[model samples]
Target chain A: MTVDVGICSTDHVNAEVYAALLSELPDANLVGISGESRERVRKQANSVGAAAMSHQELMDAADGVVICSTNAAHKALVDLALRNDVAFLCEKPLATSLATAREIRDRCAESDVVAGMAMPIRYSRPMRRLKEQYEAGAVGELIAVSGVNRGRMPGGWFVDPEQAGGGAVADHTDHIVDIVRWITGEEIEEVYAETTTRFYDIPVEDVNLLSMTLSNGASFIMDGSWSTPQKNSFWGDADVELVGTEETLAADCFGYRYDHVSDTGHGRHTESIYWGADPNNALLRDFVAAIRGESTLAAAATVDDAVRTAAVIEAAYESVERGEPVDVDR
Target chain B: MRQIVAVGPETAVRAHVERYDRFDDAAIAGLVGVSEACADGIGAPRYESVSDALRETDADGVDVCGPGAVHGDALREALDAGVPARCDPPFALDGDAFDGLVSLASDGEGWLTAYSPHRFSRLYDRLRTDVDAGAIGSIGVARIKRTAPFDGAGWNSSYAGISAAADPVDALCAVLAHDADVLEWTFGAVERVFARARSGGRYDHVHAMFAFREGGRATIETTWSDEWTPEPRVDVEYSGNQGRLHFDEHDTLTALRNGGDHGQVAPPGDDCRGGALRAFLERIEGEERPPSAVDPEGPSRAVVAVRRSVAEGRPVTLTEEGSR
Candidate 1:
């Protein structure tokens, strides 16, 4: 059976990428698109040969939904999908805060609809190999883990506190935290963070660092900084290095590409060499397969995992405010 | 010309001799070790203790390369003898010990400093220059990662010869001494520290977060494990309002501004040990006061605070008054 998918809120940066990936899947049908702006939704829908339907009509017709709206609108869209008993692939940070994330997770857990968080790092080939090596004891018992998610400060609504919920700490913390949680299979017990608006004149912080201890007693550090300047070719890096008893492993989730120097508007701009599979496409493929009931949600982040990450981010923000390490509320 | 007595195990003393030989103006006058085993393979006159070296060497300065626990007594003896001294990191065990040594140096006709080669590194010099010039605006965050290969035989043997050989805390402090110096030099005084340390037998790894008193944050992650990188991995990045400066292990510094101006800055020079030795010799000649760059007390107190944070499992705050 074809799994009908609808794009809710076609205005996000990932909306087009998701639409294109869904259109390529054989068993997945891009049924419709809905957003706050009808004109943009129609244009986005027409680009992918899908109809621009009202929010409720799209929810009623699609078998599954992809929530690609701003951070503030995630909970309401997920609520609509849950009410319609349709599965969903909510964008990263299942919700803006812990309360909403937990509420959404609980509702999804009580309902029959499948809920997955869009954390593409779990699907990256290098990350998968690293996780396999950890499980196979290539690195003995995990002792410490550190990662970096240093992307350029994403402007637009991302810098808007009202729409984005927060800045670098809010947008970038969950990906590495979720990846570490996935690799170690341990929950974060405490978080200490420091954030500043040092990189850009944005309303929220563009540089954030988080130090955490996992339940297994391993220490973790994350540099979730939007410190990458535009002069660099690539957008940013998502790399993790793990130190274990027997050995250590370091993986750059996006390091499989080549580098090119282009003489563009700027004298010299470094660009990424994309030589491997796209992680976003891999994530969409898994979402389609799960929606088709052909696979389990083990590889994908569940709503519960999102709540856990949200809790950690919450604790990190609190630590930043209090100038001390704060315990993660389990 | 200046004559320097080296004190430590054979390996550490030999390393200091090699560094001194690189400088034309300084020579190793004598060697001091705890036993004949500690003096093995050394061609210089070997003394049984720091006091013996001080009495017999006729040296202008002393270089203390002993274990972390004995650094205080070594420095005290060198200062009391009216000879300037250069010691390795974890210069003292605690703040009180550090202050006492500083007081001795102040009262005596001698100067004291710590060996922090990174402060003399050309890359660090450029970054410091840029920060002082407000090229990166007000500093918000800085990160430094230093990872070295785990030499099981080297650390196991050296640590075993120390008096506090069984204390893991002392061993880890000695390993992280240089890191503490780098943190204090770049970020100013660290007001607070929270650290998590792990050990895999021979090598210990520490990941620490710092809250600088000057309203900024920094992190230092140092590991001496068997992670085989082609070379030593060191990366330092500073983030500020106007731009960012990055120094990779390749000995290259890149400054990227927010408005699209990007360029590479040439490093000042290498031979941090050579520069440090010259500074020590100059201090011995009364050509200058203790070079502020090599002040041993700042790093000593920082190391003490970091150790306290790790042992207590909480953030340890270092007030200026308390540290002094």
Candidate 2:
């Protein structure tokens, strides 16, 4: 049975990559593509040998919708999907604003709709294995976790805090949130975040660091930045490592390669092979599986998760403004 | 651990394979550069094109230092080839492509990543000790402030792109994520956060607050884009009920055991960084506790919390029991 998908977005991730994902899944049918431009949509669809249609047409034809549009459009598209009674998968950061996210969440809940967030990092095999280790007591006792997703900036909507929802924090924070939530299966208690805009002239933040306590008495720390010095070829990279009580595992979850090539000296270098599978595909596969009644949506990040993340982001900004820790109101 | 075959334009290819000479003999490696002059002394098989590089190398991994525009495809190609890789950061030119790369990495196994040369830095190693020792006593608060100025083209080019356009607080997110080796190595989980970004002259800045799984808290601010006469500096302060730890790359253990000094005894030496790295390498060699690089998911999860904090601007908590 082929699962039909409608990718909705003008962004590069949606337009190009999602299309490729569609091609990878033999059972997935790229029925339609929708975004801001007809030409671009057609190109994206054509690239994957899929059909292109207007957003509404694609929404109506598809069994499930992949909302890859900008943050602002999340509510509108989700509402459209709900009204159409279609299951949906949305990119991380369900919305740019809390109110809008709430509206989408409420509608989905009211409709008893199935919605999954595109927090693909949770699906990584390493993460899955780590979670298992934590559960199995491989680490003796789960202690703590920390992460960084720093890189030089990539301009565009990312520069506009509103569109991208506050730069590095908005872009980088979700991955950290989802990973922690998935790994420990814990809930965030209270949150107080302080943010600053000092690196870039853009309206939003270029660098951000956030910390939180889980319900389990565990502590987590995360940092994100678009600040690495740009080189001739590579822009930036991401890495993930974890520590447990009994054991520890460190891997380049992002598969960043570091090597030394000398022109006049003996060259020594290192590279990485990505053996980890994509969490997004797993996310989509999970969503599709849930829709097919083959499996339950146990691991997927939901609208509620996005809401919590939003609430945290809101508090972080407030904390920055107040120069003090701000409690996150449940 | 991973094999690489250099790929670029014709004149840029190297003739011999360059394995990591600095590390263990077990390590596998590759190189990719644009100039043969760049690849001259490097012992790696350099290809004229990425396609050839993929075909020529039996690498389980590929490190892309290719041109920017083609980076998306380069990463896609590596992942498509079922080869995990560590590419330069800013992962892509836009969010969509970058997100796609992330999606790809997540889907693939052995796909771990981080930016900045600091994760491998010595200071990070030392800091991990204090965190793991619980020396700070539950880490009530962790604060970091990083500042740098743009001297000219050096400052502009290096800091301009994202640092100039994005929030410095986001930079904190990246740093925290990368340095998170300490956090994940110590605490256990992460959650709850808020964030804000603003502009200060040509510099971009970001500030953020976070809630740790337990009762811990963190705040960070990053300043970049402009050049000042003074060099660069970072101030890290960790506070606990017992005492506080002050660290500044150049000068660590600046302030400890103040105001009663936590009433503790027995302090470790300051060689924590080297010790940790040595430990890391030992773990890698299967002679120690466990290697930090073995599992990459937990750290990524911490990063996700940071993203949630920035996106929601409200508290994002982890699902961990009691920590909340």
Q: DockQ: which candidate is best?
A: 1
Which sections of candidate 2 miss by over 4 Å?
A12-14, A140-143, A192-194, A228-252, A255-275, B1-324
| A1-330 per-residue lDDT for model 2 (tens digits) | 777887877663544766688667766777888888888888888888878888789877888878888776788888888888778878767777667777778888888667878777777766777677677766444444556666566677767766767777777777776677776777666554444444445777665666565666444556665544333123444444343434434434656335444455645433333445776678777877777777677787788888877776776676667655566654
The segments of candidate 1 whose C-alpha lies over 4 angstroms from its true place after superposition are A264-266, B34-43, B66-70, B133-135, B149-172, B226-231, B250-270, B291-296
User: lDDT scores for all predictions?
Assistant: 0.75, 0.56
- lDDT, candidate 1, residue A181? 91
Model 2 scores a C-alpha lDDT of 0.56
**Tens digit of per-residue lDDT, candidate 1, span A227-294:** 87655667778989888776768889988888788887767766788788888888887787888897
Q: Which lDDT value does model 1 have at A298?
A: 72
lDDT of 2 by residue, B1-324 (tens): 435543433221221122133334223344454555565556455455555677776665454432222345655776666555443233443345545655666565434233322333455546667767766555545667655442322111122122221344444344344334345444545555454443333344445565555645566555444332234546676655444566763563233446632221212111222222223333333433222221344443444555555555554454432112
The CAPRI class of candidate 2 is: incorrect
